[model samples]
Target: MSGSISRRDVIQAGAAVTITAAMVSGLAERAVAGPAIIPFSVSVPETALRDLMRRLAAVRWPEAETEKGWSQGVPLHQLQRLVDYWRTSYDWRRFESQINAFSQFRTEIDGLSIHFLHVRSRHENALPIVLTHGWPGSVIEFLKVIGPLTDPTAHDGRAEDAFHVIVPSMPGYGFSDKPSAPGWNIERIARAWTELVYRLGYVRWVAQGGDLGAFVTNTLALQKPSGLIAIHLNLALAIPSPLPTEGATLAEREAITAMARHGTDGSGYFQEQATRPQTIGYSLADSPVGLAAWIYEKFQAWTDNTGAPESALTRDEMLNDITLYWLTNTAASAARLYRENNGHGPNQGVVAFPVGISIFPREIVRVPRSWADKVYPNIIHWNELNKGGHFAAFEQPAIFTQELRDCFRGVRRT
Candidate 1:
């Protein structure tokens, strides 16, 4: 049998089957001892769906914001409108069917079951790339780009640009098992990703991420794992310590101002999660409206939108992500990542591996090339995109896919 599994084989199988790492890689000695990879299909219980609908119908909405336009938080009218659609029009099974169409699986990594989507390209030599998602996001974030990435020929690109894509749900997020204890930080997650990729038998690959996933990808670069030839980040962790107050370029000054704004206005959720995840977890786990509002605020703030998040992402797209968290009951578990990092951020030190960076204009912080150089010592590719925001792939998948193709093109040979 070939090292790679054919999509037809996966599709033709009528039901989920057990596949071990040894079977995947033909490296029995190394993989046989590891956990078996179990086929997974997203089948939410009817009871859970009914319960969610009931909760949505019973939501106790708060009064509208005092000032117009998302000042205090997600506006009451906006949330009510979204809740109405969620109750009346939104369909969870539709998204579930879409996810099940792709190949999904779960395997234990460091005593935890990690859920992931693995899509193999028909192009035999397609590069393998593992994509990671952050808080308020699940494996669902990457669904839009999977088709374009895995089948470049069908998406108006050469076979050389194809990628065998892997997207994993971080610990305590989506279908992945929630951490039972502390110590599941970014470093630990990076190690788990290394074990996952190598277990699948890829001799060479790259990685890409944004938001909290960027921290994990940056950590992968820092770890310099075998087979991980390079990495790309949509959100650059390039902020320096003792942040330069003097001699600031226009871009730098603007970044500094943005940082200050984030510190003041944008960091409420950060502070809440970093300091008291469990406290907030109760409400997140119990109240559907609370979870929606919590995530909805970020969508409004982070994406490249014209006053409304819908300008950047459709109503269904936003609901798909929000529903993933709600259905999985992962709002609180995902929040714990903030507490685990303890506000450390990802700028630990110099990353010696080759790195690629795409700076979306409305990313939380628009990192300058000069700043990024200090952290990523061997910078290979850098592009400042005209549009997009924190959720790059979700907002502009075509641009995001093209960025990966361009950034990793140089290192594909190495």
Candidate 2:
């Protein structure tokens, strides 16, 4: 019991292991000491698949909502239809194979093993960019955009637009190890990401994120890591505090109203995750239907769909993300991130580094240009699209890809 501990001590203290069914097959390439990048792949155990099917089969149905729409929750019929497809036609192996085709790897950053995809562009001088995913999402969200960003020529873009892309599964999510002790906040994550980019031999790079990822990117901007040049955010966490009582623009007023509405109505999950993740964890970890309903509600509520999540993303796409959480048994660990952050809203610190903002019409709280300018003085790029929502990359990969291309184009020159 020493007051000051060593890195080895920290690692040992935090290395509380819990192996879920899915992790039995996909082991990291022979363990190397000290931050070594080891090749990794997803080979889910067949028993895990059997267990998932059995759990889905035994789901106890909940009564339909009292109303017709999603006001109460995910319409029972919609969830049933999705669950039916999940049980009958959904293919987990297809997703596994699709993701494995990319160059995936795991490395020790700090004390945790971080799982990431590193896809290099064929073109020379390709700018390196790290993409981060948030809760209820994983690297699965970026599968569609990886091609366009990594190989611009094949996807109708100039070679100059190419990005040597890196997408890391956040700590406590996907293939990454869950934290046993507290203290994996966004600031630590930003530092770890900087170390990640440096370890990968990148001297200069940019970052992009939405949701929780956006918070990390913003932290990167604040940290001003030696190599980090700029950051792009689909969800700008820059809502001015003391929201204007007078002289607010039409856009600002609308945004304020939306924020207020979300605080009142849509923050049930936020409050729960931030305050009592362990309570919800029991339901999420034990029941597949409970987990599906929990995430599916966000897909339905957050996406720019006409009425259902399918309008924004396919059943397979949504299920791929949801299943990743299920097989990995990461529901509670992921929710703890909210608790780590203390359930703060868009009150992130100001960022002076060059910043890019893309305002999706249906984002949780679309920050007006006025507020963005206040937070980011060197705003390099700002665009407001008529479509898309909170899960920008998962919903509109094409538009999201183009936004990154246009965003970094200005900085890539200087």
Candidate 3:
């Protein structure tokens, strides 16, 4: 519990295992194994990044009329600010070094290069916490919280609360390898993660994730490995059950309506990525602006930030993520994950695991608490927050951390 992730936890990152797995829903108990040190890397090349910046500066964007806000795409003014900073001010090497500084590495899992940051706490009582990131978000979302989660004592917390954080780039999202074959659904990733934590030598641990990471964590929770005491997720409503036949509460009725509406608009990316990720990936791979537009739009729409995306995060911070995609040329590979996972991945069953869910206001987690409680029979924590939207980590790390600490409080075992 005190050390960073154990070297043995690395599996010889799997080769693309065929057979697309349905989203795992049925509840089952599983075993957690430490991964063998499957060699992995998160480093980006120097020349590729420089060329990406040059391409961004010379991008020929179609200007929109004043009437058209950011509805269709990012405005020229906004893109210029980001691109200008990317060309002159943003430093990819610095960000790369910063991310790698805290024990970053990759392991081939299911034939994909899974990039992850394993930060161990110096405290004797550190809890092993696995943090997963969602779609349109790389490991950057957890960057601010890594310090707080790994060294809570330095951040004015008790040593008992320290976390040996494992932050992985979802397959195809960052430094992780893109899936070449079918399958590689969220549940498989969860299974891979179950092995991942056990390999670290922790007898019992907790997991937390938001967005796609949330879905992955949800599957991990559903698996309910022997060492998995509990799982916490920012977006916790994925498994859809029969709607409440028992008359709906005001909140539940409203939530039902929201879920219906979300299917219409909130899920555009899922459709494109699930079906035609290669097309979108090719476009994004060739054009840096396209990649920014695809990923940046989510930052604006999903975040609770105002003024500009820059207001919530420095342009450099945002570009650092986009730069990773541009340099790695993994945009297409990243999109292919959607093809592999589909909607909510494989919807297998009703899990009775001890799951805790925290819903931020501006998210698709409109499923009422009653609905959530039915699937997670052992839910012990539920929170409704006002500050952040989808990328809660970046929007409100302090709040997110506190909520996570509270969710898994008294649940870890060394």
- lDDT on C-alpha atoms for all candidate structures: 0.85, 0.85, 0.71
Error of 2 at 337 (Å): 0.1
In terms of lDDT, the poorest run of 10 residues in model 3 is 17-26
| Candidate 1 residue lDDT tens string, 162-181 | 89899999999887888989
Between candidates 2 and 3, name the one with more favorable TM-score. 2
C-alpha lDDT of candidate 3 relative to the true structure? 0.71
Residue-level lDDT of model 3, residues 1-414, one tens digit each, is: 211112233223433222211111122324334234444434454445566766877789786647566765577777777777777877777886687567665655656556778877777666778899877778888999989888887886777677888888777666666666778888788987876665555556788887778778878767788667788888765435555546889878877677666677567877898899887877887788888888887777677777567667667777877877776567787777777777553234566777777888876645567767766777878899877788888878998888878787756541
| CA deviation > 4 Å runs, candidate 1 | 1-33
- The global Cα lDDT (0 to 1) of model 1 is 0.85
Residue 237 displacement (Å), model 3? 1.6
- Could you tell me how far off, in angstroms, the CA of residue 252 lies in candidate 3 after the best superposition? 2.9
Model 2 bad stretches (over 4 Å): 1-34
**Which model, 1 or 2, shows the larger TM-score?**
1
